[model samples]
Target: TQLLEQSPQFLSIQEGENLTVYCNSSSVFSSLQWYRQEPGEGPVLLVTVVTGGEVKKLKRLTFQFGDARKDSSLHITAAQPGDTGLYLCAGSESYGNKLVFGAGTILRVKS
Candidate 1:
């Protein structure tokens, strides 16, 4: 099983809408990062939250870190067709340099 698991593996929302995807892990990390990938391209880092209970907002998106540092969530507001892509969460494991990733959440924003 992946060290991190994301809920609602897939999401389809209409444009101008809003949605949220969650990433959960039993293990704790010093920090966690979120990414978005479009077709035929590498994932671009969205944001990294290191402090527990920290929240960051970018444009119409919002991200929150769990108080325990074991989970995180991404919320998109007024979704746009161009926002359709794959969202992923990654973090370093406690034991080694291995970076564990969530299963990945696929988001489709329909126009």
Candidate 2:
């Protein structure tokens, strides 16, 4: 399989809904980073999980890293038009400055 994979490349939902995006990998990673990117803008770091089975919450977003460090997920509690953007998950071998991004999940939250 591709080093990292994301499903449903696209997502659309009404406001006030919930959604989840996933990232999967076959190889283990030392650290995984999640970023949200908007059109014509660089991705902004949302969170990073170093240890396995780590969960971090930010506002309406919840991020989790798998026990093996090979996978991760992002869950949004309540959707909004402002939540529309591309969600990318990247994995690094040893906490290096490099990252391999997933296919990306394009979220479109309708009003």
Candidate 3:
């Protein structure tokens, strides 16, 4: 079983600033996913990186998978207040397998 650990349990930043959150594990994973959850709502998928050293961009958000596939990071450029929420990272050992989730990072962006 792979155990994912996320850094910075909580983060508070001002709007328009930039920040990065990380996910790491000792065991390798086939794929890694990032999600965002708001109050009273389920986590919303942001991106998934399957290839090592791969990077995906969604608008102002950037997701990158480590060269070893054992780590990942989410970077937000010019963060906004609307981006405040819980960010979670999950790893899948293989296709069709259950994902192991990290403890999550709480992000609070103030305007």
C-alpha lDDT values of all predictions: 0.90, 0.91, 0.96
CA lDDT of 56 in candidate 1? 98
TM-score: model 2 vs. ground truth: 0.94
Q: So what's the TM-score on candidate 3?
A: 0.97
Winner by TM-score between candidate 3 and candidate 2? 3
lDDT per residue for candidate 2 within 44-89, as digits (tens), equals: 9999999899999999999999998888999998898999999999
Per-residue lDDT of model 3, residues 1-111, tens digit only: 789999889999999999999999999999999999999999999998999999999999999999999999999999999999999999997667799999999999999
lDDT, model 3, position 31 = 96
Sort by TM-score, best first: what order?
Answer: 3, 2, 1
Candidate 3 minimal-lDDT segment of 10 residues: 91-100
Candidate 2: regions farther than 4 A off: none
The true-versus-predicted C-alpha distance at residue 102 of model 3, in Å, is 0.4
Q: Rank the candidates by lDDT, best first.
A: 3, 2, 1
Counted clashes in each candidate structure? 0, 0, 0
